[model samples]
Target: MCLDVVSRLIGLHKLFLFNFYPYVQRFLQPHQREVTRLMQFVAQASHELVPPDVLEPVLRALVNNFVTERNSSDAMAMGLNAIRELCSRAPLVMNQDLLQDLVQYKNYREKSVMMAARALLHLYRVNLPTLLHKRDRGRPTEASIELKVKQYGETDAKDYVPGAEALVNDKGKKKTKEPAEPTEDNSDSDSWVDISDNEGDFEIDTDSEDDDDDDVSLTVLNNIIVTDKHISQEVSCVQVLLGKY
Candidate 1:
């Protein structure tokens, strides 16, 4: 974990230890979760793992790798974040070449990398004596929108002439009428006709004069009856009729 050991590891060309750049968060992905445990361990023990002497060289290697070798935008972003962390933690370790690389990276095609580069540049400005004017030019600012308008833009309102008229076709014009929609009354002989039943013939009464009509109730019923002892009932009815008379 010490700087001397990390430096020796970096020197070993066959090992390619610098390939595991922190800029891309997926550096440990190729290792299939094995490198993740080691990264976590290093993070937890970063103070004890990497000594002051090794920090600069390790950061330099990381910056150089991302700037040259790593093609992934994500990795470049992560590396830029790591550079910022290193600059904040130990600004003196950041060299001029590293600062210039970050500045150049501000225009990276990947938005994440550009943002990270801008952040790293800001940190560099604080830690080192970078030009102040480059800060605004390095990354877009709120004023850029207005500045762009000032450069190559126009307003929605333009100077108008009082007598201007829209173009009209006057050559070989013919008089034409649009077909009218068929009404429910079917008054027009050329109008559309319905083939179905006369349900469409019903008129919607909009006249308010019929609103005063009284309400009416109507009901109809049918009934059926059967009898077998009709003679006894007829005799009883005749006797009662004679007594009443």
Candidate 2:
């Protein structure tokens, strides 16, 4: 009935209720069920409790107790739930240090504590964007490009494949290609080519031969017979050049 009366007074005479905020702040200590109940009432009507200045102190006190004191599991859970509610309803009223301290409970061994802490963390994260009111920067205005290059160092030169990393700079060093294996045809030195000098044309060495070899000998023996008339003089000149008798 007393709690009922207080709730009624808070709803009806909210202006007067604001005046008693300091008294509530001073009296509400850790592990106090009555004080926790009153806080819950205020939290339930948080939206109507305008000018959040008073509520911030009250919630901060409860959070401080929840984080630092050895309150009952029920009380701790209540505090966590109330904080989640406060964050959703009035995020600006939350204490940053208290939220940071409460986050530690997410890693607590107790399943209920961990669960409650995680829920609160989720609530906080969900509302963070709203609280921060970040601008809708469709994308990063400043262009940033990240480049990663990996260099492998070989301790032994023998392990390096020839020309594999030729373009790669290695402390001002250059690598050359390995010599190709010799083939059988190119390995032979005394290969010969047929020579024909008196056929009205010269023959070039098609096989491996030294550049100085020019063995060409032709002798015209008798009167040269011409078949084509237009090129007859030209043919005679060629025959005379071949030492025609």
Candidate 3:
């Protein structure tokens, strides 16, 4: 396919052409087997025709080959992809209206940068679903756990305090009465309980981070809490009221 000609056709026209290419890879859905095959011919025939309107026959021909859900989706994907491809060559910028249209049509809005970003996001949705799952994920520990209090719009003012205390994972443990004294037999295992069952219950996945795999681990995505009030706003709480005689 000539890049120049493909670049000129925009909107619906460009979209139709993209579908006619059958597909760039084996990603061509199975139901679109016939439409995929038919589009190849349409694309070839389209190249020979002088009139741009002649592409309709190819569209009709391509549409005829579809009977399943995959074929239907293939047609939509092709046209949207075509328009999106052509939009890259366009000089003018696209807007929210175009983005809205692409979203409504479930097509790529190549004209708008936002639309392009959204399309890329959709591609991620289809390609990477594991990103939604929460596990033993880890983000960079660089984000200061130190408490910093600041009002809005204040850029220069910053006061750092101590970080949070060590986390205790035992949330459900109950308090028991302290024994008068420790005995020899009970001293062996008095401090702990059998946690074999809970071991598998609280499973944290350190893997399955498709997007963050290269930069950070998923295990780091956690909430940090300040354990001591003194560490936070230690100066703010200062009271200097003295009684006068």
Candidate 4:
């Protein structure tokens, strides 16, 4: 529980790795009692927030001390399990050569050890397949190949709603119609006014002003239509780039 809380903190993970990890590494030997529980604790403490360089030594020590051929079958299985848990949380700590070597233990004599090795192989096969030997890597789908590993402190570059441009265009069209309706109603009422001899010049002036208003309205509507088309084209291009068809 303490490890669970401490590992969630930002800078404290590095401190835990530096001060506490080496002490746990010492007890990973075959003769040590409750070594399995100690290894589990070590795995729980590891997280992606910690740099791979800091965690690499701990993985190497576990492999060298417990997963070796000289260790008993139980010790080897425990070591492989610990490594799997560690990698599941922070796979960047493992190098290609080390991962390739560990996956080869799938053919170990003991069933428990073999299963543990195979589980490790399966985990990487889905996540970091390039680390495994080609034969062991198997066929990956296009989406799987495109999967990107998130590095420590890395954040997404683009954070926006999809189809937002379309929404904006829709709202703009609604706003343009609202002001246009009132102008149209006023123009219709003005067209019904009675004209006399003295009002003839006034009627002519009113007609000229209406013509000017019509031209301005046409210009505004044309611009809005062109803008809508441009926004639609941009949205289509973005969809194509993202493979949305």
- lDDT of each candidate versus the true structure: 0.47, 0.53, 0.36, 0.74
Candidate 4 C-alpha lDDT tens digits along 1-245 = 56445544523344444666776777777788777777777777777666788778889888998899887898899889999999997888999999988888999889999999999999988887878887897654443454565667565453333344676566668778444445876888877867666754663335555664422344555566556556656665675457653
**Candidates by TM-score, descending order:** 4, 2, 1, 3
User: What lDDT does candidate 2 reach at residue 8?
Assistant: 55
Query: Count of backbone clashes for each model?
Result: 5, 0, 11, 0
Per-residue lDDT of model 2, residues 18-130, tens digit only:
65555556655654657666665655445433555767877776676764447767667667776776556556566556666677787776777778888877675554423
Candidate 1: list runs displaced more than 4 Å: 1-53, 130-245
RMSD of each: 35.2, 35.8, 18.9, 20.0
lDDT of 3 by residue, 131-221 (tens): 3122211223433222232222223443433331111112123344455888888888887766666666776776766656456432443
Q: For model 4, what is the C-alpha lDDT against the true structure?
A: 0.74
Arrange candidates by lDDT, descending. 4, 2, 1, 3
Instruction: For model 4, name the residue pairs that clash.
Output: none
Which candidate do you rate higher for TM-score, 2 or 4? 4
RMSD value for candidate 1: 35.2
Candidate 1, residues 1-245: lDDT per residue as tens digits? 45335534543322334333343234434224443343332232233223335456556555655544345787677667766765554455556655776778788788999898889777655434443345433333222312221111222342332112111111113334558977767767556566657878767777886665443211111111112123324433553345631
TM-score of each: 0.36, 0.43, 0.21, 0.58
Model 3 alpha-carbon drift over 4 Å, by segment: 1-73, 85-92, 106-245
List where candidate 2 sits over 4 angstroms from the true fold. Answer: 2-16, 31-36, 130-245
Number of the predicted model whose TM-score against the real structure is largest: 4
Give the Cα-based TM-score of candidate 3 against the true structure: 0.21
